[model samples]
Target: MSSGVEADIALDAAVVLSLGMNRVLGRTAGLAGRGAEALAALAAGRAEARAAALAEAESYDQALRQVLERNARIEALAETREKLDAEVALPEPLRPEEQPIEELTAWCAATDQALDGAERRLSERLAAQVAAEIFAVPGGAEGLRADLGAPAPEPTENETYANETYRTLERVLARLLPDATADDRTAVAEAARLLAGIGSPEEAEGVITEVRLRVGEANRRTEELRARERRRAAERDAAEQAEAERQYVLGSITSAFEEMGYEVQDGFETLTAGEEGAVVLSRGSWPDHSVRLRVDDAAQVRAAMVRTAPARSEDDRRLDVEREREWCEAFEAARERLGEAGVRSEVTWRLAPGVRELPVSDGARQTGTRSAQRERSREREK
Candidate 1:
């Protein structure tokens, strides 16, 4: 294969790998849409020189893989730190910055164990509080045992065992209640109120059973809800980050053109505003010919040289193969400019110069008439 074709194949492989890795990272760590930045950086390095060797392509692949792996680790650490801050609420906030991966992983494991201990302590405290409230009432203890279908307590040892069992039940209920739905919580609250004012034996008998069942179902529903939310959050973050990166890339393209001495109008919103996507127009390069660039919704940019004024005859409208070849060179230069700014240009298809006799027309209006036409042509080819 030609070197150009080889380089294109290598770049395509890199993109495929990047996309696959991005999906894996999204599933594991909620990190997606980060591969674009790595690809752009790779393009910048490639721009140092277009090396045709297969070895250079292998180097690009290795560099991109390394970038993505390192980026995933860093972002994962940051996200874990934020989550710990929000849920654990440590007395002194953790400073996870600049920490090595091994150190961060160790810290996360240690903190997780500590959080388990803390939750156990809290559960015990809640159980104690419930016990105190129950004993404070005259027949509360007896009523609770009756509610759970346990026999009434005797003296001393049996009574102590009964008290401990009831406290354990309270602790279990408390642990699951946090993950319960609003309706489940309401049911628990109602049961608490009814238990507090138990004037009869029948009422106390079923309250505990009702609470246990409600919380059990609620816990399951809550798990599903949490998973769905996490997925949605990852998707949302990916989309927003993708758009931000695209805008940054678009801005770089605009700047690259401006640096090449072309006038750019920032016509990204042209179609909605009833104009075409004619972002750049050349001046003073050729008396009757000018180069124009149109960017579509997908941010694909096309450059073409056209007549400066309306063609007055059929010959005037005829294609100029020499000019077409010249414009191709200019287009390659534009891609190089984008590479300098750390953007990748993937040329999916191109028409060879002088191969087909196609008529040339007047340049696209900055207000966007012909630019839209070119955009449609590009879409059809795709």
Candidate 2:
């Protein structure tokens, strides 16, 4: 019995030991499965954190690149502004401060008004300069104004510089060319009109040159015409003076001859009196004698006596030589009578038709005196 009881106890102890060993093994296997699940969860979290860090780093790089690009664009805009300033020779525009959009807009509007005012002033100055240069030319202001078709309007308080200059030019032209012809006035008016339209001084100079040439030509023509008229007047005056001298000499001589007891016939060679009033003389007592007298402008006198041959017979024509001697004596007595009457005379005689002058002898003069006395006695008896 004791041996059997001991065997049962040993068997119970072995079974209990086996049961405790199985429970411990099951608990250990459960702990090992829980540890492995915890490790897998931790590893998943680490992987997620690493991915978030990488995403953050990429976003920062993108932001930095954008800022750099914006800075580059601003620098480019500033460079362009500087280039514009240099090219235009303009002062730099005021930069706006960090302000509200409304305030900035107001500032821009004010700046624009200021720039407009400056532009107006500059234009006025340029116009004044051009006008001054044009006026500096000789007779330029008057010449240009005359070229204008219409008279310049009176100046007004608000008139532009260009308009004021045009008015001044018109006045100058009026004073300078007061006697201009219609054509010249028209040309000047046209030129002035064109010059008024010109904007620059250079263009005005070209027009002035052309206008001056036209005016000079017109003046020269006028002078030539006046000279021609003066010459004609002088010629007429000289002719009138010469004709008056001739008439005075002829009248004096005709009256003088009438006082010498002779009938005066036509003047010598001409029907009318000439510069020297030469005349024919006839007396009833001297039927076959021919006498001529001449008076000069200086009142000097000369006389000539001639004899006529009888055409009825050749013998009478041959006797004309003796009659010519008697005529020569009568001419000497007539010369002495004229000298006593305040006229000095030169007497000449021709013996025949083609004969020249010859002097009378003292015997011929005595015969002529006897013939005159006989003619007086015969007249008294009748």
Candidate topping TM-score: 1
Alpha-carbon lDDT, every model: 0.48, 0.42
Model 1: per-residue Cα lDDT over 116-164, one tens digit each: 5544443334333444454456765552432322354564764564455
For candidate 2, the per-residue lDDT at 188 reads 52
Count of residue pairs whose backbone atoms collide, per candidate: 1, 11
Candidate 1 residue pairs that clash: 276-368
Poorest 10 consecutive residues of model 1 by lDDT?
1-10
Residue-level lDDT of model 2, residues 101-179, one tens digit each, is 3554454456455544443333233223334444556645543332343455665565455565555543434232222
**TM-score of every model versus the real structure:** 0.54, 0.35
Off by over 4 Å in 2: 1-199, 266-279, 286-382
